[model samples]
Target: MYSKVVMDHFKTPRNVGEMKDADGMGEVGNPVCGDMMNIYIKVEDDHIKDISFLTFGCGAAIAVSSMLTDIAKGKTIEEAKKITNKSVAEALEGLPKNKLHCSNLGADALQLAIKDYEDRKAGKVRPPARPEDRHEHTHGESCKCPYCNGDVNAGLEFCSHCGKEMNDSH
Candidate 1:
């Protein structure tokens, strides 16, 4: 199941709309399940000064989006990028296995949004579409956060599971 905060967000999400001039924006959706979430970020001096989300799906999706925005605000771009699905799940106690993918959607959306922001800053290629547009994709690629799951990324100096420092990168 989900927590009270999770449920509250699911029932009545705060900041559940879009920003006209958002600094960063991310939209994550699972094509298989048709669950989608859109998160918006307003950054100030490299910090996520304000955040919000709009999700069109189940409780897990709404909860993850709500929790992600709460966690992302006030964090630097680097720190915000480090926010993982595991962390979001932990913040909500835990999510059912089937619902676990919701965390992945949330994390991925946030990451892509921040990436979009960074790209804009560096004059990189702008996203092909608007930030809120739903792009179809599979889940669970870099989805595993080894710090809480299994093994880390290959050649990772730190555990991909726990994010703990490791002696060897290989």
Candidate 2:
């Protein structure tokens, strides 16, 4: 029941591996659901020369990771950081409602990778202690409302702080 794009990515996922000398790296996870993804990037002169991903997850996770790498490559670090879950899902045509979280996994992975690269350039942070990576954070943390930075509980009807109606499908 997978979409055509998802099927294609699953069949021949692109940029699926590690970059031993990656300029940056990022990982994200939904430990409760056991989906984890690590993304790596290679940079040259502030431009993304390559992007790759390794995922311990399902079909959707693989597809999202592949799509994310493809989209992030050739983009500058700043440009890559702007990539979002909505854009990843759009690039894949569409994912099943339940699989939307996979897109978040991809976005987070990219953001982490970009952050790593930036940190390296600025000498602000170091790489992982181990190459065995996973998603950086767990679930139940991203459902917050952006407008007011308020805690939006799962399945809430409105933003408790801003009185804004929450989209049913978000």
Q: Which candidate has the top score in TM-score? A: 2
Kindly list the per-residue Cα lDDT of model 1 for residues 110-137, writing each as its tens digit.
Answer: 9988987887788887747664343332
Worst 10 contiguous positions by lDDT, candidate 1? 134-143
Q: Lowest summed lDDT over 10 consecutive residues: which window, candidate 2? A: 131-140
**Per-candidate alpha-carbon RMSD to the true structure:** 11.6, 8.0
Writing each residue's lDDT as its tens digit, candidate 2 over 78-129 gives: 7887999999999999999999999999999889888887888888967445
TM-score, predicted candidate 1 vs. hidden true structure: 0.71
lDDT of 2: 0.85
Runs off by more than 4 Å, candidate 1: 30-32, 127-170
